[model samples]
Target: MIALDIENVTKSFGGVRALTGVTLSLNEGERLVLLGPNGAGKTTLFHSISGNILASSGRISLFGDDITQLPPDARARLGLARTFQITNLFAQLTVLENILLAVCGAQKLTFKFVRPLDRYDDIQKRARALLEEWNLVDAADRLVRNLSYGEQRQVEVVMALSGEPRILLLDEPTAGLSPAETLRVMEMVRKLPRDMTIVMIEHDMDVAFEIADRIAVMHQGRVIAEGDEAAIRGNQQVSDIYLGVE
Candidate 1:
């Protein structure tokens, strides 16, 4: 089944066209990576889909329902979740507290602040399980500010997953990590449920090739090429333009 469908989506910032006539679709459980050089509109496309930015023209649908008019929180409620390229976490909170807060946020109970924090036992349990699944159990009690960069990324991933969205959008998830850390994040990504649809924008071809079931290359605000790993690797246009081949 098609999990996401974007048709002729275009966005502009004043006189500058950020995304132009872009159309793409993803099937359930499919992992798609968007590849491009800097300023290729990769992030623009992501923001458009996640409702962080509205498209100037075109349609976006999630699971066959048009979501063009929905806001980001509404999109999240409809099983769409995204992580940004930069880490966004509660610096002063413990790792466990951050996850618990995410769980509360997902449940729409974040406004119930007068209650004791310990009242959310189920949230804590689920958060701990998520940490353990991501191999972050040992760091759960540490303050988020005290953790390593890679560990903080893992925490962000857990927060993204806490809502159990059907479609996951990740933006440069492995950025700033060492090779070993990048591989670890990739491994965790691999362990995600097979029924979850994933769309990511990545600059790292190695990381994109490793996790992507298919790759779409964007250039100058358009989808220039798209195919599976081997097909993309062999495409002359992709090689000459985006892949830096002569």
Candidate 2:
């Protein structure tokens, strides 16, 4: 089953084109890694798919239903969730609080603006389960700002999963971590259920190769090559533009 279908998607900022005629698709439960240099429009493509920014042209569908015109929240409701390249968290809130908010937002549960979230037993149970499953229970009460950078990153991933999304878009989840931290994030990703589809933007070649069932290499503003590790490793253009020849 195809979970996502992006066809000829294009995005432009005035005269500058960020994504040009980009087309891609993902099967249910597949993991896809997007590889590109700094100006390769990888993030722009993410924004277009997640509806952070609308495509200048083209079609996007989720599970055979056209979602090109849906808003981000609507997309989220349709089992789509995404994390940004940068950490987008409530720094002032405790880790548990952040996860609670995510669950609340995802389920669209109604609560008074100032009411305590603990009032919802189901929400609290869901949040705690995520923390325990992610091995983040120890830091659940700590402020997000107080946790280490790597810990914070892990929390972000857990929060994204709180909604139990079918399609998760992760943008540079390991962007600024040390080797150890990177490994930790990798483990968290590996532990996720095999049936959830994931599309990630990663600059780390090793991580990309290790996690991706398939890879799409972008250059300038388009995907120039896409295939399994062996195919991308053998592509001369991919080597010249993104991955250097060994």
Candidate 3:
């Protein structure tokens, strides 16, 4: 089953091209990682899929439904979710509170301020389960601002999961983390429900290859090579650009 389909997608900023006729498809429940050097248009492809930016040409479909021009929030409402390369979370909110907000937002209850946060019994239960699964139950009440950087990033992941997205785009989820912290995140991602599809952009070679079922290598605004780990490791072109031959 195909969960995502990108056909000849392109993005241009005036005369400069960010993504050039990129075409790719992702299967349901597949863990796909995008590998490339900086400015390779990896993030540009992500932004296009997430509806953060419009593609200059071509179409993007989610679960067989055309969503090329769908606005970001509309796409999100239809079970598409993504995280940024940088951490984006509510710093003033507690870990539990942040999850609660995500649940409420996903349910279109964000404007329902008439009731207290605790009144949403179902959302609260879901939030607690996420906290337990992410192993942050002990810090449920800690404000995100007070947690360590790694912990905060975990909270970001928790919030993204709280919505139960069908397809999740993780952009550099472990970027800037210490080696130990990165392994902790790797474990978390490994434990995620297998039914959820993940398309991730990761610069960590070890982590990227370890978790990826297939990898798409982007270069100069296009996908130069795509295959399983062994094929990617042996590709001459991929070695020339992103992976140094040495």
Local distance difference test values of all predictions, in order: 0.88, 0.90, 0.87
Tens-place lDDT digits, model 3, residues 46-67: 9999999999999999988899
lDDT of 1 at 19: 95
Candidate 1 ranges with C-alpha deviation above 4 Å: 109-119, 243-246
Error of 3 at 159 (Å): 0.7
* lDDT of candidate 1 over 1-246, digit per residue (tens): 899999999999999999999999999999999998788899999999999999999999999889997899888888998899878899999999999888878867233444566547767788888888888888989999998888888889889999889999998888999888888888889999999999988888888998999999998899988998888888787778764662
Ranking by lDDT: 2, 1, 3
Task: Give the winner by TM-score.
Answer: 2
Model 3 TM-score relative to the real fold: 0.92
Sort every candidate by TM-score, greatest first.
2, 1, 3
Q: What is the C-alpha RMSD of each candidate to the true structure, in Å?
A: 2.6, 2.8, 2.5
